[model samples]
Target: MCNEGCLIADLELTFTVKGSHEGSQKILLDSDPSLRIIVFHCVINEQTRLDVTLPEELADGNETVKSGVLSFPLNSLPVQKEIIVEEEAGVVNKYNNRKIIANLSGDLDVRLGFNLCMEEQEFLRKRKKYVAAALKKILHLEEDLKEHEVPVVAITTTGGGTRSLTAMYGSLLGLQKLNLLDCISYIGGLSGTTWTMANLYEDANWSQKYLEDAIKEARKQVTKSKICCFSLDCLKYYYEDLKERTKEGHNTSFIDLWGLVIESMLHDKKDEHRLSDQRQTVDNGQNPLPIYVAINLKSGYSAQAFREWLEFTPYEVGLLKYGASIRAEHFGSEFFMGRLVKRLSETRICYMQGMWSSIFSIDVMYVWNLAADSEDFWCRWTRDRVTDIAEEPFLSMNPYEVDTCLFTPSSVLSSALRDVLTGRPTIAQYPNFIRGFQMHSKYLESEGFSTWKDTVIDSFPNKLMETADDELSLVDTGFFINTSYPPLLRSKREVDVILHLNYSGGSQTLPLDQIAKYISGQGIPFPKIEISEEDRENLKECYVFEDADSPQAPTVLFFPLVNDTFKKYKAPGVERTPEEMAEGKVDVSTILSPFTTREVCFSEENFDKLVKLTDYNVLNNEKLIIRALRLAVARRKQRKY
Candidate 1:
């Protein structure tokens, strides 16, 4: 199990000899008659050392018996050792040693390049075939077309806590009903939208037919009381599991507890599923490629600071900002000095989902309030202690600031309080984003790969040198751009149409504007989002934007979850008014709210209505959807010629 050139030296042993003596002759006994002999074999440096110990009784009182040490020259020792096994006694069933020899003679290629992994390349090949067939049917074309004629469309869902989860489901169902889902090549999601995507992918056969059932199950889970998270049994399980993870070199924190909460709402228990586990569901190329998004945390940057988006797919997980990529299976494994030091177990899907949708980390105060009201004294005391140290600050500020404060404690009591609140592990103890190089000098020499040499490295400070380790802490992408655009805009994908499913409670234009600004800043191409003042004043359910000059830019089909055209009622935010509450609308004012104390958990009827509203928002905009499809098809065909 050792790497090349690993050394081993020094050997010591103590043995008690036992044997019976023959008349007038001291005899070293063998495993027969009245004596037993045991032999020990030691293998080192391709040599063997054998030591035989005789029974001590044979030398107990014999004057002729004497103990002597035997030494063998390194060169004289045999290079091979023999193993004897007794089949009748069943001493040893089999014997074999596993040896792995690797050749590292050539110049190492460490350049960061932009290209899809083999799995994604194969997926695209099959997916394009599926897309072409679906498009032929959608366009009602009689003739079969070449693969290049099919468009690569990516539909991205926005982040808005649980609201987006429900709305995304409805929108997907609407697309399914129009037979448009089969035409999508990729589906990108961030925050709550990732939650829905993660759950949907859990079932391999998921489709529009199963959408209603999934929604019903999700509503059942979400509408349930938060009491389960604080129950003695649940608390015990969390305590034991977190302790185990901490012992195993994992970074455990209160955010992990949020993962537990999410697990309960989504999978009803701790799910051991990995992101790559979803590959089975999409291996046949029947479903759109699912990409979950997160952002890396800079040392001194605020959540609003524009950061690189870390994209996660079933095959690979990495950053498009620097064109760096790694196999998804190796995400949490240890990588040191441009090589893998160790390969740890793949991270659970719940943990990855928790990290991706960690906007819930900001709701510590609400969680504390819930804890304080719990019947368990331990829960109440723990919450009280946490609140006593930093209540007002955490309530007013974002979770990223709170995390920084937790790491940089000002006083002994604050340090103790931080330890208690963060589950006895420092921020550095947790697993983080993998780094390209462990040493700053090596990073400077190689520039973290040629693609990142001039651009990505210059954009950020030398925080790696300041920190003892090379990894970076990452959190939810909603902290930067709520909509996931960077991953979708990867040059390799060449997406021709991007369906933006906006479920934010804010102005409908805000998400699109933020995405457009972010992509422009990053030098990633996308159609300019030009929303007129009139359009903003009277927002519609869907809007289409195209870049006529740049046919390569994907046509953006923005669908903001709105109530103006679908229903008379307005879409509620985290909080709701009395009238809105009375109508049985969602009022998640006390649940997993992103930034405030107000949270909303929709009732069954209202949840159904919200689903219906989202469905109609897409279904009612059939003309616009058709027109966007036509434009994408025409543009794709034009490119083919």
Candidate 2:
């Protein structure tokens, strides 16, 4: 024989394979290095043999080769593999795996209404017990507790930029002081209200004495220089952080820059806080369940559109529209086909804050100048200049008045230039870019995932309803209801009372009215808001609405922040005089506008007045709060009987 034919005479080939349906196998090929191994699918729980054969070159060798058979026992495979198979088959044998079940937790399940997650239901049970004990002590209802059921109460805070944030802090502090905080089961907020919530939850003992200290520190920080967008050092930090996020496969946007700005303002430092980190605050049943709200964005969408509320909690983040939820830790991970495609680190809480507060989309310079002018700083700066060009034409314009001048292509170019120089995008077009699954039309129809109820899914109006796009654009929930409601009203929550804190500048009934209309349209039960013309014209500090026809509808205790009730000297729509402001009356105009930069440096007096005003609003209406709780308890008793 030639030397080439006998070169591999001492070679041995071994094959090893392992799987649950298949098992480990070892094959031996003697005297030939080049050989082919083939294994066919095996029957359930049956032994399968591996076929090892020589290659064409080896078969033609002059040297003799030995072949050996290998057998595998499938039944001896790992139990973990069997568990995975069962999970893939959509049968969850353990309650622990219920959260990650794709079919139930998937965002495509539109037919499913809003429901609490497994974890939330467990938490709520503990919370209700805690509340019942607290209420019994506070209301002196220990004897009546046996005859009545404890009510599920949710308190919702409204959005009004930083002013609303400070006010909400005061309101919560009042509740805490009155021993009512422990009785609340859920705390929901949107926009500026979320700012207060985020800051408070940073400490695990926030409902205790720490809240007052946090509020004081927050006031001091809020009064400092508000223009982080214009600060070179802050902008550098923002750029580096955003660049790192982009490298990690996230699409950087202006919202990221706004998050950086908010981080500087709220924390007075870099924000390293993650959304999942908040679990510690609510862990061990310490605090009320916290819900942060955002909205899904599609092209040409409005508040009246079929809007979806995206709820964020310590345990999970998901959409109420689709009844889908994922662990809060997995919110930013790459998801596909209702499962994680690539595991990514959880999103920073700062980004979520930015999304919650992303109601402004104008140029940073305009916002800055508007703030200065509203506080009369801009006017003073131009007093000594020439009369002709001294005052910037836009300086005198209100937010809505300057929209045409501030939102042009030229402004966008200027903003881009600033972004390039400062390394921060200061204008946000949308809050976040969301990743989702790509499903075929047939699969969607078969699974009842179509946007339409009938077979006319082909003609769905919203492009997002089309299967072509596998991602969603989400923005602030303020664009929709502005007052966080959907999360508290989920069918599983069964909330009997909702304390609606209205801080928006619109009509006092706007938040409650909008939520009632939206919930009614969705067929979600809510108390009918029948506000008389007299109540609308002279809005009170608080109003209550009840649905006589439906016992299931939660009673709404609507509280609108108005100057007439407590701070009568501070007239509505009238700018407070410097003397009155110094005398400790908050200028309602300064605190109520949509403008973001007003009162960048709130005086100690101004800060105290805002807090006092908010606190008084709640304290003055203590009877209303107690009555709402009483009514809720009565309704629960009625249902039980």
Candidate 3:
């Protein structure tokens, strides 16, 4: 794809070599490979433009008190001075044996920049119509609501394999029944719940249609025989899929393999669905715009110290923190210094799903344990309470940090494949768009990057910009926080309400102590979470948390996946008979529970039980939900006045 004045070199970091001596610090080039040296450098014209050795503050560290900040409505990017070191040897083939003439084509650069893409801006303008109509209908307002006056309502669902997938459908079903589905302006999720959003968006008019049929189809997929997924034929299909993706110059990892497995389990055939294709679902403001989330973390960076959240929409894939984005179709394409170097085929939605929900990157057993622990992690927090020693191991061994592994390959193929991918990092790779950008000198005091004093390395400017590497390691947002709140929290979004569904293995959905701390730390406006000790231990099905003192903070309605009244009343006021009462007794807390995150093949009965529970819970809480919506509108009007 390169014409002239183009340089392509493979960058391999060798940690073991330090002047032919063994060490843990990473030093590029040579053999030792024992020491991990952290350095950042930029090169132009086969010469080093800038190189800085990163500090050791984040090398061995835990979570810190870095205040993450983001500026909204960035209409202009920081003007950067490009430095080009020149050499006349570029046109001459000194490295190649054959003399070749270079093609100097017109400099028609295509780089998605810091300003919000035009596509999203147009989407917001169109989406307002739907929001206005839905708000007027649901709020029972006689007068038609003005488009600008409409409150931005978002629904955020967390991830948990099939459990979340089934529950998401049920929640949406209930919303549709209540005529509240259209009221939502945006819907987003991470991990398994993304599956629900993907499948729904495949149908352009899903939000307008009755969701019962979709639910039934999802139920079938969830209940099918997963054994065949690992069978030889499916394995061959996976091999070919990976082979093709690799041939296309895509980085293949265990995550890709898991995506193929997920494809077979959730889909009947290979699909051409891409994130960009979903624009049709929201083209006429007929459906909520979907925001799928993934996070970026460097290989050696402290998982706790740094997290770069990437939000994907039909229009663009962006990092709200940096105010930088690329067109959705250009997401996986190679880029350098704010220019698209090479264009790869847009990634299929299945692979996107894999990147969004990459829990299988490591071993399954450990993931299950993490799920079992994560359920209550939110509730077990106090402002004074630190993540106890018991939780350290889980925190330290992030899935991306662990070696990628495979399961259930028949005969020797599985073994051979496992060996080939055994040591690769557990993350999907994409060319970093932020590459070649220089960090602001006084960024330590900048409003965008708050000067943090709490963390060791996070306090350093160079370390904060260290993620400006060649490739971005995008993995499931579950690595940072399971909730899909980050993207919605962007100041530009101006969201007024958040309906958070905890479909993962969690007893408490609102886990305010944890979620509150995280949001407050980032300087985002969120409701105060003050659950009493009594409430923390025993979570309620629905919670409405808000900062009465601060109207800017969005009102959050948290719904945890707990078996509550759905047991006594199967379908919102429909009482279960003596014989059918057993159906209400859903095992939501056990590792072997029907709603376990680890189980892909849920029995039909369990699927119904789980799906119905979410459906029934939403229906039962309809009055409360509507009340919240009304309050949100009232607040929006108050602000308008």
Candidate 4:
């Protein structure tokens, strides 16, 4: 596919292309991701980027580059062309007539590293008042909680389709009621929980305001019929949305269609808000930073075999393993060689929400067998178009090195359109910003990429080349680990406490065990999450894990979705009356839960029960949560960064 970006037309190299006996003795006839038009840089300098715009008449079907400027449609690709130069050197360059487009240039928007982005850094400063007030009010601090002694506290939840989407509302409501939401530094999610985050973030001041109304709204959404999403009219709506996106040079796959359904389910009317728009909520740090999680899987590989962690915040969208990130607004825009070449319209947040929680995209059993550790989902997207993919799709390939295969992928939208025809699940690809860029030569041997002995492609030199490919195939993190633990564990985040709400709903396997194994392999400092098999048979409302071996391991307060003391009491000390007893008898069994992983509909009664149960679970454990927070504060005080 033709990259919809800019290129550098060199007049000095044009002479070499015309069989010149003498010139610079170097010919650089290649594709650059940032240029458009055939406007040649007649000056011999190959490194300069000129700020020249083509005249308006250039797009009037001009035959070729003329009057020192080449005009072509923005969507056209470059092809072999004979150009005559008016320069004294008699420069002439030959490239195919395929039209190439130029991208707007300025300072790059990407911020590369493991450190937090500047916006997030500025937010921490703004959040000091709210957190101190929360500590005093929630913990009843005898003295002020100093800003310097503050601990980075985070809350995380797992995915279980609609089950998670609704239960998360209850979980956050619980936090808000207890005044715990104000103390959190970050709130992260996987799959289903993202839908809840997207909904709440729209309110901007969601955390500062009372949460009952939001939970009530959630009740309405869950109780309503999801049948309309599959109605004939909805299909037409999806078709039109995708078609319009394609015309605007954006990619549209089956996932895009799924996003529209999610959009309708969450909002009755059109909500045109993008993720960047939510920056208003955290711009002054009134709320916890939101981190949405996904995993990057290679095109031809099984998720179990190769998967990398990806995170989306209102400030940025990036892959942590590569330590590479782009501005949140640049997510879908085309990028080549570390520069934003084509700025496609930022996708609506609904589309991103769909990608984060698209459990229906693949077979349920496949998701269960390959995964099923804790998270719940349906059809898993595994691409079968292996042969059709470019052999070294991660890196730029020369024409002669690879056969003249009928290359189909041009822009991401082109591949997305292909997915529509085949009816197979998509890889949720975006333009790889680091495409055409190489990793550190010693990346394999460095402590950065891998500290463990996994045989993953990124670990081996020959196989790691795939990291340089042109598109990123990001899928739900559930396809690998069932939780969103990796991003929070990044060392620079300096998190002291993690309130992990296990909304993933399945009962068989321990999700934390899966997370522990993955985190250990990545060499992150995390509390030892060891739960006995006996404990597995019977879950509790909450369990706290802390590091006895190392202080760096953040304390974890894990609350599984189990109806325990909430069924026995109205509050911590208040016993339930006979009529109220039934209110507490909410069933969250993996098999019998009204909020099952695949459950899309819930009665108002059951919905309230789920929300209340989750709320009670948090309320009952108030002392434990506070103790964890105090411990986190002490840990923060003793540790020196």
Report lDDT (CA) for all predictions. Answer: 0.62, 0.61, 0.69, 0.70
Instruction: Compose the digit string of candidate 2's lDDT tens values, residues 403-468.
Output: 332222323333443454345332233212133332345534432233212222223534444433
Find the 10 residues in a row with the least total lDDT in model 2: 1-10
- Model 4 per-residue lDDT tens digits across residues 1-641: 12222233432122111111111122233545342233321111233222223223322243544323333332232233322322322223332132334333345456666678889889987786788788877767788877777888898888887778777888787788888888998999878888888988998899989988888788888888766554446646766788888898876676776678778777787679898998999998899989999887776678888777779999898877767799899899876556665788888988897688755555433323333233221112212222333456765456557553443333344344335735757557777766644566676565545533243576465454444465778788777777888788887777889998887766624678888877777777877877787777887778899986788788999999887788889877899998888898888884766766766678889888888878888888988999998887777667665
How high is the lDDT of residue 499 in model 1? 88
Residue 156's lDDT within candidate 3 is: 87
| TM-score, cand. 3 | 0.75
What TM-score number comes out for model 2? 0.69
- Ranked candidates (TM-score, high to low): 4, 3, 1, 2
What is the C-alpha local distance difference test score of candidate 2? 0.61
Superposed model 2: Cα runs more than 4 Å off: 1-114, 144-148, 300-303, 361-363, 368-465, 568-584, 589-601
**Of 1 and 3, the candidate ranking higher by lDDT:** 3
- Candidate whose TM-score is highest: 4
Where does candidate 1 stray beyond 4 Å? 1-4, 8-112, 303-306, 368-467, 568-600
Candidate 1 per-residue C-alpha lDDT over 1-641 given as tens digits, one digit per residue, 9 for 90 to 100: 11121111111112321110110112232224233222221112333222222223223333433333322322343233322212222111221121112122332122245777779989988888778887788878787767777788999877877788878888988888888888898999887888898888888767525577887888886567665665656656766776776676666666676666677656667788888888977788878999998877656556564355578999888766455566777787655323455567777877777677777666644654564464354433343333332455544555455432233224443343345565522122233434433233434444223222323334344553333444656677777667787777877788988889988765667878987876676556678888889879877878899889988788988887666544434332233455654443333222443322134355577667667778877887777877777788777778745
Tell me the number of clashing residue pairs for each predicted model: 13, 0, 12, 31
